[model samples]
Target chain A: MKKHIAVVSGDGIGPDIVREALKVLFAVGAKFGHTFTTSSYLAGGAALDAVGIPLPEETLDGCRNSDSVLLGAVGGPKWDTLASNLRPEKALLGLRGGLGLFCNLRPAILYKQLSDACPLKAEIIGEGLDLMVVRELTGGIYFGERGRTDDAAFDTMAYTVGEIERIVRKAFEIAQKRSKRLCSVDKANILNTSQLWREVVKRVQGDYPDVEVSHLYVDNAAMQLVRNPRQFDVIVTENMFGDILSDEASQITGSIGMLPSASLREDSYGMYEPIHGSAPDIAGKDLANPIATILSVAMMLRYSFGLQAEADCIESAVSKVLDNGYRTADIHTPGMKKIGTNDMGSLIAQSL
Target chain B: MKKHIAVVSGDGIGPDIVREALKVLFAVGAKFGHTFTTSSYLAGGAALDAVGIPLPEETLDGCRNSDSVLLGAVGGPKWDTLASNLRPEKALLGLRGGLGLFCNLRPAILYKQLSDACPLKAEIIGEGLDLMVVRELTGGIYFGERGRTDDAAFDTMAYTVGEIERIVRKAFEIAQKRSKRLCSVDKANILNTSQLWREVVKRVQGDYPDVEVSHLYVDNAAMQLVRNPRQFDVIVTENMFGDILSDEASQITGSIGMLPSASLREDSYGMYEPIHGSAPDIAGKDLANPIATILSVAMMLRYSFGLQAEADCIESAVSKVLDNGYRTADIHTPGMKKIGTNDMGSLIAQSL
Candidate 1:
């Protein structure tokens, strides 16, 4: 099989970690008797510095031509002084909007080795935490009409029935693939947006008879995520609420550095990236964790390239490395051998 | 001092908890040399049943004439099938809106003896968790324009300059009186409402010279609350965001049954209530926890009646009872004796 993957080595430690993901990808390709061609492109603060645009047209073209797009984390304080419109974070957000990617799948899985590190009790954390959060990427409060006046300011939490139905349908499809359980989270008890959300979700649920559907107020859902994360299978929510809930869900795994996300449209190709931001404070240093970016590569393989075996290989290799007591600063557990950026990445690749 | 309190024992566990809170209130009044008179009114499902209106005109008149109002939980499944406008929860929400109760303060405090009940590690949970969540009760998505069409729906997240200023000022004022630290949580990185929120908070900081101000995105704030809840002193956010975040914050202390909230307007007396909802399933069994309602009574004394000693007495009594390991179903910590609702209430009053 031949696959072309576009890589965006975004900023700070993005390049270093991305290198390891590529190595792991190459190893998987070889093991599975498959060939993968990688193309690298500039984005985020680095692109702004090099080519004067956070997301250059060349980068978009490269991604559109590829089987999948893998991104390292973006933005740093160095670009903080940039105009809000030209800031590095916008590049990532803009790409999602520009690509018409409406479904963001963020899987929050707690590994057995990292269970003790979670704030929740061992009993509450359960054996395996596997929940996919299907966040509506292009709609809701994030892209709503927003502005500030001298006396007032406002942002809309708008949702189209078409948008809600599509995202809900996507979530139901994913649930069909997984545990066949879906929980739609909204603030229906208070907000009008949520009331409409509930109505649309109910209508959408009728289409998926196999999927078990439940509704939770956002506040209760947030509490339940920490109290018993194992209870959830697939959580679908609006953009801003999903943005907040998904991050909190990542924390349940006891490692933000291990979480990866993918934003996709109806097409097979998608943008994959680690959940963490560019830590400018630790940029030049070797302290940034690379597992998140590496895991993202695994997602790119499974979700985009349809190389499940190769994706499993990358995932298993990372798990084995962690099982061997390797640690990065962000996810350091007791007695784990603390390793730097290149060393950890090398260990993962070596395991692969 | 002499005071009259409008007591609205709502529905479900409303009457049970209100009875306990009144016992403690009477004890506090006697201990502090204050004269207290309570007029019990019907609201919520019960009021709707009796007067055919959730918030009766007489009840509103009672609240306006009284020095303070203490509400037990509202709503039940019996009334859930009623019209949306006639439902029980609408009454509580109606009172807040009608009374112009803008500042909603929910304090998440972990008792010393109950610290063992926290799911997080003792080192992370630390000695005590006390943080007041100041939510703008009157504005944002709650009261914003909302509508649903055949294919789309919208809910505005609007904030006026005056609303933001007042809420931020209230938070800083509360912070100055406590740990001298305030955290303003918003989605500033994404929403225009939050962007204006940040600017308003900065401008308001000048007025509170002694307090330190910190800003965090709502997502990061949610993670930090779980990661290290002890780091925060006070958190001020918009209405809907606060609704979710405060609930999450309350869960960190192990049970929603232990948290209380106070909603106040500038010129009027405040309304105090427990953060927990009516547990319709356990309404008649006398199994619901009443500590939150009792604590809410304490808040009514302090914030509305200016009865500091009376408030302190009620708080101390509740803590002493918890120290004695009298458990309710909600806070069923290990090895703790689970007692019935009335017994726990009696124990708290006995401690007083």
Candidate 2:
């Protein structure tokens, strides 16, 4: 198999982490007998520095032309003073919008090796926590019409049947592949958008009768996430509710630095990245964790490339490394051997 | 001082819990040398049963005429099949709107005696969690324009300058009274209403210079609530965000059964109630937890009647009862002396 990968190593430790991820990806390709070609694209603060914009047209074109996109992290204090639209973070919004990435998959998994970092009690965590938050990225309040007048300001939270249907269907499909349980969360009792969301999800439920479906008010869902996170499998919700709930879910894991996320379009094309921001303070120090970025490569393989076995191998490598007490600075314990970012990536690749 | 109190003992364990709270209130009044006159009003499921509406005109008038109102839990499964407007839950909304209660104060306090009930690990719940969420209750998306078309549905999240001002002022004043630290939660980076909310809060900060203020996006705030709940003092946000966050905050305490909330208007007139619902299963079984309702009475005295000392006495007395290992069935643990609702309330009253 031959694949073209677009690499957007944005800023600070982004380049360092992406470099390690690329090494691991190349190692996987070599071991699995796959041909992978990569093209570099300037984006985020890097683009703003090289060019005048956060997301150059050439960079977006490069990503669109590629089979899949691999991003590290974006934004830092250096670009914080820029206008909102010109800020380094705008590159992320621009790419997602330009690529039509509607579904964002954020998996919050508390590995048993890192269970000591979990904020929840042992009883609440049960046998470790692993849940995916399927967030609708393109629609809902985030993209709604918003304006401010002299005395008042308003934002319209609107959703169409098509928007809700697609996201719910994607969530159902993901659930079908996982535990066959999906919980669609919305404030159906109050918001008209949520009511319609529920209606659309219920309508879509007929297509996948094998997957069990449940509905919860957003508020109750937030509470349930903290009270019993282990009960959830796949949580689907609108953009705003998803934003809040996913962040809440990630925090409970107590290992935010090790989480990976995937933003996918209608097709198999997706952009995979680590959930953590660029650590400018530790940039070039080899102190950053590369496991998240490596796992992101694994997600790209499974979701975008359809290489399930390859993805599983990479994931198992990660688990095995952690089981062997190989820790990065972010997840280091007293007895664990603390390895550099490059070393950690190499360790996982070697294990594979 | 002579005060008029409207008591709304709605449904299920509502009447029982209110009875216990009344006992504590009267005890406080007797000890503080304050004269209190009470009037009973029907609302929620009880009103729906007696009259055709969940919130009757007579009940609204009674609540309006009183200096303050004390309410137990409302709504039960019996009224679940009623029309949207006729539902027992609608009574709470109707009262808030009719009474012009704009600011809702939800205190998520994890009592030291009940630390074992907290879902978070010992380190995360340092010194016990105690924070207040000041939510703008009568406005924002819940009361804003909402409609469902054939293909799309929308809800308008709008906030006027005056609306934001009043709520921010209320929150700041509360923060001044408590920890003097206010964290304003909003999606300012995304939504117009939140942007306006942030502006109004910053402007209001000038009036309360002594109070420390910080801002967090709603998503980050949700994460921080789980990561380190002790970092927050007073979290002020719009209605929908508040609804989700306060519930999340309460769940971390692991004792939702013992939380109280207050809804206030411009003046000292406020309505207080337990955050829990009407548990119809235990309606007249003497198994209800009255601590939340009793705490609501404490809030009523502090906010409405301005009886600080009296409120302190009531709070301390309730704490003493818990310290003595007396618990209601809902919050009872092993080795704790579980008492009936009436007995628990009487014990706190006697201590007062």
Q: For residues A139-257, what per-residue lDDT tens digits would candidate 1 score against the true structure? A: 88888888889878898888877888888888998899889999999988767677777898898788899999999989999888877788899999999889889988988777778
- Give per-residue CA lDDT, model 2, range B108-219, as digits (tens): 9999999998999998888898899999998898888988899999999999999999999999999999999999999887788998999898888999999999999999
DockQ of all candidate complexes: 0.76, 0.91
Model 1: runs farther than 4 Å from truth?
A284-287, B333-335
| Model 2 vs. true fold: TM | 0.99
Question: Which regions in candidate 2 have their CA more than 4 angstroms from the true location?
Answer: none
Could you tell me every candidate's TM-score relative to the true structure? 0.97, 0.99
Comparing only chain B with the true structure, the TM-scores of all models are 0.96, 0.99
Top candidate on DockQ is 2
lDDT of 1 by residue, B170-278 (tens): 8888898899999999988788888888999988888888999899989999899888888899999999889889988888887678888999888548999999988
